[model samples]
Target: MENTTETTKLLVSDRCDVCGAQAYMRVQLAGGELLFCAHHGNANKAKLEPITLEWHDQSSDLNQA
Candidate 1:
């Protein structure tokens, strides 16, 4: 058995690469990491999903207080 843990997380300070909004998703690819806000994430999902290694989504956290 093996144990694995998440090494990176998208923080409030992290901004979307496209829009400069607070990032809620972090996409890991061969090139590098791409941070995205909810809007941009959904817009590019079709293209990124195939090549993404990790999709670190934290949008649900927005509802938390």
Candidate 2:
């Protein structure tokens, strides 16, 4: 199935997907998945719609950690 929802389109980086706060020195896997903090990621999501490919979701815990 193809994901058309803005929530699913954005690809999670191997870095900090939460809060979009990536550290200079960190650890991440190829697909381990990076998660974002709900408060930050979803807070300004509406404004990011146009430029972002993701809807910004942190409702559920990501498997990265």
Candidate 3:
């Protein structure tokens, strides 16, 4: 497994990697970390892999269940 704890530093610190806007979702992958503004996260989810880690704050869609 990759050290996402360390990779977190390499990911965008403040803004979304896709649109460079305020990030509403944080996409943590095995090999890379990504910060996505709500638009991009929901927009590109078809390409983003789902994660198993516990996210303190998660997308409302999941919380609905």
On lDDT, the leading prediction is: 1
- Pick by TM-score: 1 or 3, better one: 1
- What is every candidate's alpha-carbon RMSD to the true fold? 2.5, 9.7, 7.6
Give the least accurate 10-residue stretch of model 1, judged by summed lDDT: 1-10
How close to the true structure is residue 35 of candidate 3, measured as C-alpha lDDT? 74
Residues 1-65 of candidate 2 have per-residue lDDT tens digits of 75645434334452344445532112123434334455554554555545553233434534454
Please provide TM-scores, in order, for all candidate models, with all chains considered together.
0.83, 0.33, 0.55
Those runs of model 1 whose alpha carbons end farther than 4 Å from true positions after fitting are 1-6
Worst 10 residues of 3 by lDDT: 52-61
Model 1, residue pairs in steric clash: none
In order, the Cα lDDT scores of the candidates are: 0.85, 0.41, 0.57
Better of 1 and 2 by TM-score: 1
Segments of candidate 3 deviating more than 4 angstroms: 1-13, 50-65
Please report the TM-score between candidate 2 and the true structure: 0.33
Residue 32 of candidate 1: its Cα lDDT?
96
Residue-level error in angstroms, candidate 2, position 34: 9.9
CA shift of 46, model 3, Å: 1.8
